[model samples]
Target: MSGADLSRLSLNTATVKHADLRTAVDAAASAGYGAVGLWRDRVQEVGAERAARIVAEAGLRVSSLCRGGFLTAADDAGVEAALDDNRRAIDEAATVGTRELVFVVGGLSGSSPGGPPGAATDRDLVATRSRVADRLAELAPFAEARGVRIALEPLHPVFAADRAVISTLAQALDLAAPFAPGAVGVVVDTYHVWWDPELRAGVARAGREGRLACYQVCDWILPLASDALLSRGHVGDGYVDFAAVTTWVADAGYRGDVEVEIFNETVWDAPVAATVATVAERWERHVAPHLAPSPGAGMRLLDAPGERP
Candidate 1:
């Protein structure tokens, strides 16, 4: 990637999971990122209202909220509880001043850490996915009322049995079809959707339908971790062809912030300054060039304190 400006880049707080909201926002701003994607835990650290004040004081925008969707509960009571939690999450997103709320729809019924795959034990994949759709229908109006868009994120197929059941951008788009574009949308995350055979067409479909609410980038490194969820790498460190996927998103008319949401333990353990600088450098080199020039494309970017010259 080349020529793209830094005006459109955003730092996802999960990439620096150890930092508090204030520190993360400040680090992102100092690194010249235009926005920051917040996680619910970080926001609740000092309360959403104060968290919004911190981000606003840093002169950065809140790109999106980390999540709000575990709607795969089996019984009526469980379903209603999930809906209530999502409603609270939507309210938090509004308080934090962002329009996009990213949702990682839950896995199978009995899935648990260190347990058998839910698919092997439950075998009710169809029922679980249907629950997600039904829950979205229930939450859509509430999100719309607060000017928030529920951005459904499709995890890689590897996570279907434990983390998220929606495993392709096409599936997410299909799920978002019943609601107004402003109410429901889809997240195009490279780490998750990069391997889909239908990725190109799916991205185009998302753009055409105005469902492309968020675009995230990270590399799928090999030699998977024991947990598998921690396998993300910095841009250019893995095999993802950012130039190709970025071009598709740009061509699809998505001009929103491009977030760097890494899940690697190594990245999270690194110093906040070093991680932020590395994200800027890698994003500029591997993911920025293919992007459509954002407004204020030539805006000045401050060099983070230890950034390599």
Candidate 2:
């Protein structure tokens, strides 16, 4: 296989929840990753100022922030609060030098009478989608002003009931179309979108329209767990074919970082260093080979530390 650059691999902080923000950044740097993705809560915990310094000191690129979602609460007060929070997230991203703020637009307010109250009933899905789009409209300008792109990540259908009504890439792109170029776009997370029937088409559309701002990788399992939110699999552990997905992404002209943003309980339980090392190894052994040139080619794969192999 031809050599491929592993410098494009990024570590999303949530993958190593065992560590704090500074430690996560340091670990990613030490592990030879090209960049690191941060979580807002962790940044808050470490104090944004300190977190920013650590990342910069490590010479790590802040790829994107994990979230600035929950912008679709039922009441105006909740909506306002979400907006305020998102603005702060944007500020934080800017301070940390991240170019994108990933958003998981939240689900409806209140649980269903029989099940999760926040799960949208047939009557409310459309309205909820509209509210989310409107909220995005309201915040897009401010985010753009701060030089932060809003990457609207369409969570999987499993999360449609309680996380986001926008469960498809098509819908996310449509929602972002109203905003300026690069101002609002969609994040393609393999865990959420790998099963989409229109996955290739959606990705092609994203590329065609220049709306593909972020790309995340994780795995999805069959016999989905009773609780779907936290059961994400690692890169090669489950059903997702990262080789195919990566091909499509690269073919679609996405030259951005391929971020690994797993939130599995199993991964989180491991020590942060072990977790980072495992992800790096997985990226090299599994994901990287597929991106290499055809067999018999003579090329050197770029190492994780930005050195050519």
Candidate 3:
């Protein structure tokens, strides 16, 4: 694909966190990316207003906010606090002109601070998922009113005990189905869902139901470490076949930006500019070819006239 064609790819800021928000945005824009996926902490670090200005000035689109979940807890007070935080996050995304807010639906209530410690157990996993769904139902209307779509990201099952209770696209869709149309959706991250036995069916279901909001691309590795959360592989460096996954999504009618969301510590240790450049290059060479619009393809990349070449 041409550089212009590669412009459809977006860089999620976590892929290059060695730099601050301003530096990451600058690098993404300089590398000819169309959009960026942002993390709330980074925005807060730089000040949301300043971050908004920087992104707007660089002509970079905020593809999606990295997070707004963790609303599920063991108590009402914690859930309320999470809702309040989510409202603020919505405001930030609106201020930055982003349309989607990715949510990592949190784990059992007692697993984290503010949670009822020791309440999380294998026996309570189902109850925890129900709690998350109820919370999502409450927050969906608030997000919808702000024009921010909630993209529920299902984390790997390895994180089922502590990171996210929603661990599969199927579960995410079921939880989101109670909401009004377009209010809730799922974020398909290759790193998280690559090992799912029902991945293709889940992608199809997401696309068929119009519940696919964000498509984050990354690779997964084996000999998995038990303690590392940021050791994700770059595109094509691991076992995932991006070609097949993107084709499945494209066939299912998704036409949004293909976000490169590598959270690998190795990538983060590199200079921001180098990391962004390498991600953009790898995305084009490995992932873009799969998502490219062919004459008979079901969906096409949104036309980006005047985008840098």
Best by TM-score: 1
Name the best candidate (by lDDT). Answer: 1
Error of 1 at 141 (Å): 0.5
Model 3 residue 37 CA deviation (Å) reads 0.7
Candidate ordering by TM-score (highest first)? 1, 3, 2
State, as a TM-score between 0 and 1, how close model 3 is to the true structure.
Answer: 0.90
What is the Cα-based lDDT of residue 266 in candidate 2?
Answer: 79
The candidates, ranked best first by lDDT, are: 1, 3, 2
lDDT (tens digit, per residue) of candidate 2 on 1-309: 213355778899888877888788888887778888899888889777888888888887888887887776767787889989999988988887888899988776553322645334344777878888888888888999999999999988877777777899999988988987568878999999888889987876776677778889888875666567677877788988888877666655567787898877778899888887878877886677665433322222121121111
Candidate 1 overall Cα lDDT vs. reference? 0.88
Q: Which stretches in model 2 have alpha-carbon errors above 4 Å?
A: 1-5, 112-115, 118-123, 290-309
Candidate 2, residue 56: Cα displacement in angstroms equals: 1.3
Error of 2 at 229 (Å): 1.4
Which regions of candidate 3 are displaced past 4 Å? 1-4, 113-123, 293-309
Better of 1 and 3 by lDDT: 1
List model 3 lDDT by residue over 69-180, tens digit each.
8876667788789889888987887777788889987876667533335634334887878888787878888889988888899998878767898889998888888885
Q: Give per-model CA RMSD.
A: 7.6, 6.2, 5.1
Residue-pair clashes per candidate: 1, 7, 0
